[model samples]
Target: MDYATYIAGLPRVLAGAGVIFRDAEDRILLVEPNYRRDGKWILPGGTVESDEGETPRQAARREAAEEIGLDVALGPLLAVDWVPGTGRPPLVSYLYDGGVLDEAQLAAIRLQEAELTAWRLVAQDEAGSYLAADMQRRIRAALGALAAGRGAAELEDGYGPADLRAR
Candidate 1:
């Protein structure tokens, strides 16, 4: 096959990035996306513009800024998940640590009216009630990685097994 044909024949998947922010009280910040009718919440992030040469970190920063008016130095990555879509292609999701948001940072939040309707800090345990099952698992993996002080947790379908979480 020609080089172009070979490249086109390769497997493809979508890429996205998100930031996991925390409150001083250790509550995780979740955002309500307007696109979902089920009232499910998610972390602040969007698709990675890889075609435009955007890295996951840059995508996280950009999404944070666009979704919540946030502009702070992000901490290390907490999780990297391979999420299989229901009908669409699979997604390679990067979850970065946004660290703890101080009062000043919290006060500066300006939700993107078109995309988000609200944002709130929810306790880790309470997060499952507001987030989708996969998201809840992703959050758990992310937090576990953060607490472990290890590098990013690797997940498959949002479940990061014990062995894969610390790498």
Candidate 2:
């Protein structure tokens, strides 16, 4: 289980899980950071922690509630990103699709000032410029698979933006 590698890298490694919730109208939910650096814009998520009897999914829900104040219904896995040798820290990011909860359900959020500042629902088309290259690709894959009546697409195998280019 690569326990040795996992342990040796703990201080410099992290695992994060997050979801991109979508509504029936097909709009995608996104959060904008109050600040930006290194030309990077990221989604709302944080390090996945291991608590007694808690799974990664549970951690993800907790992160969502902590960051956005909503209890999300988690759906299928969308992507698994590996960030090794990126110079900051090695990370494995799990991206999921927490099915949409009504807007009326959103209340004032308690955000981690260190992670986010604002969030909004964006049309699938605008995701490119706003998100980092990889995140944009993941959003495109999720939207494409959703539009085709299939379940979530895996990002592990890799795909190109042209696979999701606007029609």
Candidate 3:
């Protein structure tokens, strides 16, 4: 097969990266996107530009800076979610730890005017009201991982139990 044909036949998937930013009170930061007609509140993130040679972690940090105007050293990986697609390729989402921001860092948040209309720090219990069901699940799992000091988690469609071991 020709190089073009081989490349064309290769599988393709879209990738996205987001940061889970929290405040001193442990509320998650949620952004209301202006570009979405459905008005889904989401974490600060966007699609990874493959052409830019950016890794998922880099993309997450860049998105945080671009969307929230906060330059922070991102913590470890929190969760990776593989979302099934409708008509297109599936989406692989990476969620990173933005770490708990102090009062000073929280005071400096500035939403990107072009993409976000508002931002709020919502408690964990109230995240479901602001986020989609799948996203809420992902965030909850990530929070659990954070509290336990465990490594990154793998999720399918935002659900856990990545592996089952015999008793």
Candidate 4:
């Protein structure tokens, strides 16, 4: 079978999420999957379904609700990525800027057992160690874009519109 055929048999359309929450000192939110396949820690994200007729922002908000049981205020598009040779099909991820109501809400988080086991609020410097190299770059770039009053937009080499999960 060709690559397209192989990917078609895999799971749902791959998507992305912007892990956002507040710490005691007003930091960002992040999550760690319960299991590690590639021995890497990834940000919170999942599939983007075409049937949902949703934009990337809608997909991010949906993932936040389903994965963490929380409603998120979706912000600008943060970053885009493509994961290659990762067992599953090549994935196109659309990251967004997500925020919660307040820091107090971080305490009441309820994780979706089937997806994530727990969540954490980490400081900016601490993020690089816990997250994968690619994620670390994206997060840092997104933060930088937000700080500079610009939206983050980076397309990994070899990734194109055809890679989008919505397709």
Candidate 5:
């Protein structure tokens, strides 16, 4: 087969990285994208630039810094959600713990005007009101794993408990 044919036949998947940042009040930080017509509030993150050979964790950290101007150390992987896409290849999303930011860090937040318009810390219960249903599920599962002292979770379409038993 020609190189072009081989490349065309290769399976492709898109990857994105996001950080789950919480305040001392345990509220999740969410951002509103200025470009989205739907006006969905989303976690501070963006697509991993594959050409840069960026790992998911690195992408998460970079995105957090670029989006919120907070340069805090990222914690463990909270969750990995595999989402089915529409008119595109599936996506694997990585969520990292941004480690609870202090008041100083919160006060320093500066949204990227080109991509984000505003950001706010929302209570866990009210997160659903701002985020899409799938995002709400992913956040809730990550929070549960955090509270239970469990390691990272693998999810299918943001659905939980990841059925990791041997197939």
Candidate 6:
């Protein structure tokens, strides 16, 4: 096929990037989105604007600023999850470390009311109750990756790099 035809025939996939911000106590930051009625909380992030020539890292920074009103320099990438379709195209998500937030920074938060209803810092163990299964996995993997002092962890459907019952 010709270049244009080949490009047009390529499978479509969605991409997102997020920043994992933590409190001084090391609690993970989670946001309640106004869009989801299911009540699942998520990290600060959104769809990558590829059409606007935005990269994953740039998207993460932009989303963080938009959602939580903080402009921060991100740390190393923590995790990447590949999620299959539930009712739409597949998705690939990138997670980066936003580092710790000080008291002043925490107090300065201004939620993007159009998208977020509230935000909280939840303990690592408490993340499960607020997040989706896939999200829990991604967060665990990201934290594990950070703790292990390694590079990013790869996940499939937010499950595992596990060919087995894995971490």
> Among these predicted structures, which one has the highest lDDT?
6
The TM-scores, one per candidate, come to: 0.94, 0.72, 0.93, 0.74, 0.91, 0.95
TM-score top scorer: 6
Candidate no. 4 TM-score: 0.74
Estimate the overall C-alpha local distance difference test score of candidate 5.
0.88
lDDT of each candidate versus the true structure: 0.92, 0.67, 0.90, 0.66, 0.88, 0.93
lDDT tens readout by residue for model 1, 67-118: 9999778899999999988889999999999999999999999999999999
lDDT: which is higher, 1 or 6? 6
| Prediction-by-prediction clash tally | 0, 0, 0, 1, 0, 0
Residue lDDT tens for model 5, 83-117: 99999999999898887888899999999998999
Tens digits of lDDT, candidate 6, 25-138:
999999999999789999999999999999999999999999999999999999998888978999999999999999999999999999999999999998999999889989
Off by over 4 Å in 2: 1-13, 51-54, 107-110, 145-152, 156-167
For lDDT, candidate 3 versus 6, the one ahead is 6
Candidate 1: stretches off by over 4 Å = 162-167
lDDT of 4 by residue, 14-122 (tens): 5555554445465667776877765555556666765677766777778788877777777777667666646665666777777544645665567888767667777
lDDT of 5 at 13: 97
Mind giving the per-residue lDDT tens digits that candidate 2 earns over 41-78?
56656668854555667777788888777777677776
lDDT of 4 at 7: 84
Q: Candidate 6 clashing pairs?
A: none
Rank by TM-score, highest first: 6, 1, 3, 5, 4, 2
Looking at candidate 5, the ten consecutive residues that score lowest on lDDT are 158-167
In model 6, the number of clashes is 0
lDDT of 1 at 72: 71
Residue 15 lDDT (model 5): 97
Candidate 3 local distance difference test against the native: 0.90
What local lDDT does model 3 show for residue 132? Answer: 85
